[model samples]
Target: MISEPDLVKYLPDCQFGVNSATRLRFDFRNSGSGERVRAPWYRPLCRQDFLRPRTAAMEYPLGRHNFLRSNNLEEMQDVLGRIMCPHRLSYLDKPEPLDAVINSFDLGNLVLNYVQYGVPIAVDPGATGDFYALQIPLYGNALVRSGGKTIISTPEIMAVTDPEAPLYMELERSTKLLLVRADWDFANRVLRDLTGGLLPWKLRFDLGLDVSAGRQCQWFTEVVNLVRRADVGGGMLKGPMWVPQLEESMVARLIQLHAHRYSELLATPAMPASQRVFGQVVDKIEAMPEQLHTEGSLASEFDVSSRSLRSAFQRYLETSLFGKLWHVRLHRAHLDLLWATPEETTVPAVAERWGLWEPLFTQRYGENYGETPEQTLRR
Candidate 1:
C-alpha cells in the first residue's frame, strides 16, 4: 500500500510537510522532448506522428496536488490551445488570477484530471481536434454549445463532446471541472471487442449526459473517483498489472452511460439462453473451467454481445456467467483436493490449479463452502 507521501516522489519538485502535507509541481515545460504531456491540456498529446515543437513559453501543471495560478492570457491560451482544443478566450469579466487546482493521474491511454477552472471565461467555437473529451463540472454551471445545440452543465449533468464537433463554452465563477480524455481508437476497439466486432462505420456521441440519478451513473462516478484516488495514493496505475483492467472498466462505463450513434445496437435486448450461442458459451465454460475468461473474451468467442450473454445466464441459470464459472472452478478444485496425495498437495496448490490463487481465493472459497480449503481437504 503506497501512502500519499510515497506518491510525492513521482511528482516533479515535490516537498514534504506534516501529516499528509505534500506539495508537488509538474511544470510541463521541464518535461522535455514530448516525453509526457498531461492530457486534454497538452496540445501535442494525441497526434505525435505530426509533432511540432512550440516556440511559445507554455507552463502547465501535471500534479499530484498543485495550484495553477496564472494571469497571463497568452500563456493560458498557449497551454489550453495546444493541450486541449485551439480556442480564443474571452473574459466575461477581467479574469482575476485564474486559480485552478489540479490533481491528475495519467493511465497511459487515458488521462483523468480533477481541475477547478476558478474564473469565468467565454471560449470561441471551433472543432476540438481530439478523440473524446468529457467535462463534468462539480459546481457552478457552464453553457456548452456544439452543432448549434446547447447544454448547461451542472453537478448532476456532464458534457461528453465528440472530437470532430465544434465546442464553445461559457464558464461561470468557481466552476470546477472534472475532465477525462480518452483515445478514440482505443475506445472503439474496446466497444468492438465487447460487442463481438459489430459496429457502425462512424461512432458519434451525444453532447450531454444526464447523471442525475441512476445505478449506472452512480457506478460510473464511483469507479472514476476510485481510479483517481488510487492513482494519487499508490501509483497503482503506473504499473501494467492492473492498468488494462482499470482502463477497460472506465471506458466500458463511459460507453454504457453516454448515448452514441450505435447506442441502440449495444442496448439491444439480450437473446434467450436457449439460443445455440449461449449453450456453446456454457459448454466452453464447463469443459475448461481453468481457462481464462471474461465477459468480453467469452462474448467474442461465441460471436455475441456480452450484455446478451450475461442476460441469458441470468434468465436461465439464475446466476451470472461469472458466478457459474466460479462454482465450476470450485467444484473442480474440490475434486483435485480429494484426488491429491497428502504429501503431494497443499490447499494453495489445489487452488492455483483451478485459477483461484490464495489470499482472495481462500476467503471466497471459505465463504461459499463454510470452511477453509485445508479443512475441506481434511474431509
Candidate 2:
C-alpha cells in the first residue's frame, strides 16, 4: 500500500474542461414526517430494484449529504480528492454538458458517496491506494479496468477496486454511481475477524461483483440502508458507538458475500462474541422485555447489526434474541397469572398483557413449567 503523501505526489492534475452546464437539485417530499423511509437492517432487495422507490426525477440519492455541485473539472478534482484519494480525471468520450454532483457521508473508516459526472468521463487513479471501492451504477453502465482485468459494470453487475491495484473507469453519461469507499486497515480487520485469521492481509475481491441475488443482494440492501439512514438523518450512524458497528456490518457483509481468497474458510463457523457486546445486548433485553422488539430494532438501538446480535444470542444464551425475549415476557406473564384471581384476570388477559396470545402462552408455559397458563391462573 502507498502512503497518502506519496500517492498524491505521483498523481497529476485532472485534465478536463471547466465548461459550465445545468445544475440539479434534490426533492424532499416527506422530509420530517418520520415515515418517509422505514429502513431496516439488510433486508434483501429485489434484484431489479437497486434504488429506493423515492427515486424520481425530483428525488435524489444522498440528497441530504450533498456538499458539492459544480461544472469546473479542476474544482471537482480537488473537491473529490479531498474526500477520496487524489486521482486524475479525463474524458473518455466527447464530454457532454458537464454537471458533476457529489454527496458523501462517512461511517467510521468507510464513506458512502454518491457521484455523477454528468458526462462521459474517464477516471485514472493509478494505484487504488489503501482503500477499497465498491462502485455500483445507479443509472448507467461503466467500463472498469483494474489489476489487468476489465469488466462492464452496471446496476446488477458492480465493480470493486482492490486497495493495492491500478484502476481506471470509463463511465457513460447516464451513470449515477454509489461508491462505498472503505479504509483498508479497518475493512481488513473485519475480514480477519470474520475468518478468525491470526494475521491481517489485503483481501482481494474479483473484478466484477454481481448483486443479482443471494448474499450479494443482501449486501446491497445493507448498503442502501446505510445510505438511506444518512440521507434520512436518523442520527443512527452519527453516534460514537454506531460508527464502528456500521463499518463492521458493511465490511462483514462484503467478506461474507463477495468471493475472495479465503472464502472457503468462512464456513469454519466464526467464533462467538469475545467482547462485551453480548452482555450489552443481554442487559438491554432483560431491562425491558415488555417493549415491542424486532431483531433489527434491537440491533439498531444497541448500535449493532441484526446478524451480529443474533449470532451473539445464539452462541451465549443457546437461543435466538427473540427466544430470550419470549422467556422474559413469559416469566412476567406467569407472575401475573399466579398473583391475580380468575375474577380479576383470565388466561387471555394475562398473555395479552405481555404481547402474547392465549394459545402461544399456554403452549410455551406448558413446555417450560410443565403446566398451562389456565392451570397457573386457577392456582
Candidate 3:
C-alpha cells in the first residue's frame, strides 16, 4: 500500500481552503478470516468565484477527502473557448492508490474538487455506475483507450467517459484533469433528446485544435471566454433556464459539425450517366416554360415511360416533381395575392402567373388557405 507522506508531496495547490486538512483513521474488525479494513475520512470545504463578464459569482463548499473518491478542457483557440478556470484542494495524511467506486450525483450539482496526478493517471472501466464523468485535459494529452481503440485527447478535445464501461487513459506527461461526476440518467436523456437521437452510444467531444485566425476560431474563443466567466460553483438549477438549454444546443452543434465532416469524407461521386440525363431534361423544362412545363412534357423530355419521371423526382427530392412544382407556383401566387398593390395584383393575374388560369386556382387556394384567391387579393 502507498504511504500517506508520499501522497501529500504529490498534492497540488489547495483551491478549497488555506486551512483545509486531511487525516486518516483506521478500524480493524475481525470477520471470520482476520480483520476488515475501514478508514474514516473528512474533507475540508472552500469556495471560489469564476470572475467572468457575462455571469454572476458562483460559490460552493467542497472537501479534498471527498474529491474523486466522491464525484467528478481544450486548446489556446479551442482551449480559450471551452473551459473556465478549475481549482482543486486536498488534505490527505498519507499516500494511497485511488480505487474505482460507484458514485452518483445530480447533473447540475456543482462541486469544488480537483485531481492532481504526479504521474499520468489511468482509469479502469466498470459497469453502468451512477455518475457521468466529464474529463477536461488542461495541460498535456490524456490518452484514452477502450474497446480495442485509442484516442489521444488534449485541451482541444473533451472526453465524457461512461462509468458503465471499462475505461483507461495514460498521460505522456504529468496532467491536470477536471472530473465532473454528473447524473447519468439525466445527462443521457437530455443529450439524446436534444441531439435528435444521433449521438453515439458513448459521450465524447473532439474540439479540434486548429486555432488559426478565422471566424470558427473566433467563435471557439468566445465559448471558452464564456466558460472562464461562468460560475462553475453555482449549481445549474439556480442559474437561468437558458443556461442549460444553451449548453445543450452548443453540444448538439458541435456533434453536427463533426458528423458533417465525417460525412464529407465518406461521400462518393455522383453517377455520370444519371447526372447527364437528368441535367439535360431538367434544364430544358426550366428554360422553355411552354413545352416542358407540364407533367406530360416533363415525362417526354426525360424519355421515361408514364409515371417514371414522377418516381425519379420522388427519389431525388422526396416528393413528386409535379406536386413540388405546383406547390412552388401556389406559394408564389399566395405571396403575390398577399403583398401586391391592389390595382396591379388581381386574382386573375396571380392565377395566370402561377399557370392556374381557371377556377382551379381559386378552389385550391381556398382549400389550402381557407380563403379564395380573390378574397386573399382583396385583403
Candidate 4:
C-alpha cells in the first residue's frame, strides 16, 4: 500500500483507503467542500458483490467477469484526477489471479490504464453513445473488430475503435493491454481544432504497442515508471497545480506518438466550405499581423456576409472568427516579445505590429499571458 505521508503529500485533498481485501477506494474533493465529489477504484470481486442498481449489473460481460467501477456522476472528472494524481496501487486486487492487472489514472482530461492478464477475456462495445477506446497489446496476440473490419495486433500491437460504433475484441490466450478512455468533449475538441473541425467522427489511431524494442518503447516505459513512482510517492510529488498540466501533456504526447504511427486515420475527406473559409481567414490574419481590420473588412474580403462569416467560424472553430484572429495576433506578438532581439522589440511596437492599438489590448494581453506586454518586454 502507498504510505499515508506520501498520499497526503501527492493528493492533499483526497481520501485513500482499502475496503476489505479486494476493494480500493480514493475519494477526491474540492478544497472548500471537503466532501468527496468522486470515488474511483478497482474491484477484484465478482460484479454481484457490489450492491449497485440492477441496471449496472446488466451492463456486465456475459458469464464470469472482473471489472472496475467509479461511483460518481462526475466520473470523468474523478477518474481523470485519480489516474494523474501521482499515486500507486499497493496491491493487486487478485493474487495470482492473472499476471494481468488493470492500472488506472486520472490526468484531468483523460483516464488511462494498462491491463495485463494471464487469461484472455472477450469485450463488447457499449450502447448509447459514441466514445473512443484504444487497445494495445503488449504481449501475445489479439483480434479487434470494428464495424465488420477486423485488425489483428500481435505482441506489441494496438488498435482503436469508436465507442459510438460497435466493436468486439477476442484475445488469443491471455494478453496484456493498455486501454484509455477519454472525455468525448475534450477529445473531439482537441482533434477538431487540430484538424480544423473537418472530420466527422472522433479520430482513432492504432499503435503497434511495440515499445519493448525501440526508443519509442523506452520512452513509454520511462513515462509509465514516472507516473507509477509519482502515484506511490517515491519522492516525486510536486504541488497539485502542476499535476494537471503534466498529466495532460503526457496523454497528449501519447496521442501524438500513436497518431504519427497511424497517419491514415487522419486522412479523411475534405473539410466543409465553412471550415475552409475560416482556415483561410486565419491564414490571412497570421500572415498580415499588422493589418488591424474589423470583421466587416474580413467578411468583405471573403465576399460573404458578416453574419455568414461569424457562423462559419462558430461551426468550425467553436469561437468567433474575429476572436480567434485577435488571439493569434496577440499570441504572435507575445512570442516576438519572448524571442525577438531587444533592438527589434518594444511593447508599443509589438502591439502595433499585432494591430492592438486600443487600450483594451493591454488588458486582454495581461489576462491571457498573466503579465502586461511591458512586463514581458522587461523580461
What is the lDDT of every predicted structure here? 0.59, 0.66, 0.39, 0.48
Which 10 consecutive residues of model 3 have the lowest summed lDDT?
Answer: 55-64
Question: Candidate 4 at residue 231, lDDT?
Answer: 42
Ordered by TM-score, highest first, the candidates read 2, 1, 4, 3
lDDT of 1 at 150: 91
Candidate 2 positional error at 175, Å: 0.6
Give candidate 3 misplaced runs (Cα > 4 Å): 1-114, 127-134, 160-164, 179-223, 232-240, 260-379
TM-scores, all candidates, are 0.60, 0.62, 0.34, 0.39
- The best candidate in terms of TM-score: 2
lDDT of 4 by residue, 1-379 (tens): 1122333333333333323223323233322354433332233211222212233222221101223443222332243334422111222232223233335654545555655443444554432144455566544567777645677875345565654556666664445555665565555544443334345555554424444344344334434334333343312223342233334334444554555423454344333347667777878877875564444456557655444555566577766544565577778888888887667777877766555544556777888899988777777
Displacement of the residue 252 alpha carbon in candidate 2, Å = 0.7
- lDDT by residue for model 1 (1-379), tens: 1122222322212222221122111223212264543222112011222122232222332343333445555566655555555779778897566654455555766767655445788877477665677777655688998766799987657787766778888888656677777778778766876566657565567888876545445434444444334433432233343355457656766786677767777677656534687789988989987665666667777777666776787787766665677678878887777777668888866765665544556666777778877877776
Where's the lowest-lDDT run of ten residues in candidate 4? 56-65
- Compose the digit string of candidate 2's lDDT tens values, residues 1-379: 1112221221111111111121112222333352443221123321223244444322456777776888878888888888888999987776544678888887758888988887889988877688888888876789999888999998778898877889989988767788888888776666654543355457888889887665576467557756765665533343342345446656766877788787777655644553487787777778887665555455556655555665777678767655676678789888898899999998876665666543345666898789888888889
Each prediction's Cα RMSD? Answer: 12.6, 14.5, 22.0, 17.4
Cα-lDDT of candidate 3: 0.39
